[model samples]
Target: MKGAERIEIDRRYCKGCMLCQYVCKYEVFEVGQERSALDYLMPRAAKLENCRVCRLCESHCPDMALVVVAKKKGKGKE
Candidate 1:
């Protein structure tokens, strides 16, 4: 199965509730020192390789700031 290419969290809309970190089964997120536009600490997507593109973080984000980008499958590669 194709995996995640990356996860994008928009700091402008994020509130740093850390729901993304709590929802992630792979421990992909962590509390970072960076602050968002609203002056709240942001969660960092650290262990990107462990992500499965399940979109749990995306769905769980209260501010809808999280986006999980899945790897595109190659045509006829299988």
Candidate 2:
């Protein structure tokens, strides 16, 4: 799981809605004080180490504020 992709949240579009955190079975997200452009608290990737590269948050975000990027492996070892 160490080399898996990470999930990122866009603070600008976030509305303090914890749907992303709620939908994550791996508990990869948490509420943070970072205010959004809309003046609302936002959630953050607090437990990225537990993420399994699942795109549940991306598909569940109503504001389209979540992004799950698949980390690219360097070099040509594949």
Candidate 3:
């Protein structure tokens, strides 16, 4: 199965619309208490392991604040 390396949320531009959370099928995000520079509630990557590298959250982000980094591919058993 594909896995994600990390999920990044740019706090500076995030409007906290939470479209990423709504689009995510893996439930990788949660409502966080932390506020962004825009003074909106930011979502936290609570369940990193749940992410399947689908990039749904990234595409759904209106502010383009969410970034999903997929695990690097390795050349093995070639």
Off by over 4 Å in 2: 1-5, 74-78
Poorly placed runs, candidate 3 (over 4 Å): 74-78
Worst 10 residues of 2 by lDDT: 1-10
Query: In candidate 2, what are the lDDT values of residues 1-78, reduced to their tens digit?
Result: 333466667877888889989999988888887899999888878878787777888899999998888777677644
Q: Is candidate 2 or candidate 3 better by lDDT?
A: 3
- Native-to-model Cα distance after best TM-score fit, residue 29 in candidate 3, in Å: 0.6
lDDT of every predicted structure (CA atoms): 0.89, 0.81, 0.89
What would the per-residue lDDT of candidate 1 be over residues 1-78, giving only the tens digit for each residue? 657898888989999999999988899889999999999999988888898888989998888998999888889853
Deviation in angstroms for 74 in model 2? 5.5
